[model samples]
Target: MDAESQRVLEYLTEVEEGAEDVLATKQQIVDLDTKRNQNREALNALKTEMSDSGHPELRGYNLSPLSTEEIKAMNSILKR
Candidate 1:
């Protein structure tokens, strides 16, 4: 093959490498956005829990839940 053909092959290789890099960066951005949205949802849930003073009691047997002290500490953190 001619030198011109070799140069065209090299240029195509370079472009392919760049396209791969762009795809990887785009994937990272998508992952980060998903994480951010999930965190936002969690924060909203926390806010709702904090604002709602009355938590319904759970009945029906031997369910060992958080101690009253632990519950208080969690509530305090939510307050801040």
Candidate 2:
């Protein structure tokens, strides 16, 4: 092939690879966002259940009706 044709082919190849990378990155971001939302819902449900049940631990700690941020912080701390 001519030099110009070869260069064009190479550029097109690079563009295709970059597009694939962007698509994969976007998919990862979407998946993480979905997971985060699910986790938040689960946390909220658990908090409601805990408060409704009047769990002894929460009563002892005076942590009834936990706020989302407080639960998130506690979850992070417990994970560590």
Candidate 3:
């Protein structure tokens, strides 16, 4: 085969690989989003349960109606 033809084939192969990589990354992003939603649902359920449990200690600590964002902020502060 001529050098130019080989170069074209190599370029096309690279393009295909790049497309495959993009597809894989997109799938990974979708999977992560699904996992995040599931985690959020579970966390929300736990918060409701904590509130319904009527635990005096939880009320005292004000953790029964916990907000996910608040927890994230607390973690950020602690990290600092």
- Give the alpha-carbon lDDT of every model: 0.93, 0.94, 0.93
All candidates: TM-score: 0.64, 0.67, 0.65
Candidate number with greatest lDDT: 2
Which 10-residue window in model 3 sums to the lowest lDDT? 57-66
Judged by lDDT against the true structure, how good is candidate 1?
A: 0.93
- For model 3, residues 1-80, the per-residue Cα lDDT tens digits are 99999999999999999999999999999999999999999999999998788767645654466599999999999999
Q: In candidate 1, what are the lDDT values of residues 1-80, reduced to their tens digit?
A: 99999999999999999999999999999999999999999999999987785544643466789999999999999999
What is every candidate's alpha-carbon RMSD to the true fold?
Answer: 14.1, 16.8, 16.6
Top candidate (TM-score) = 2
How much is 67 displaced in model 1, in angstroms? 39
Tens-digit lDDT track of model 2 for 1-80? 99999999999999999999999999999999999999999999999997788856645664469899999999999999
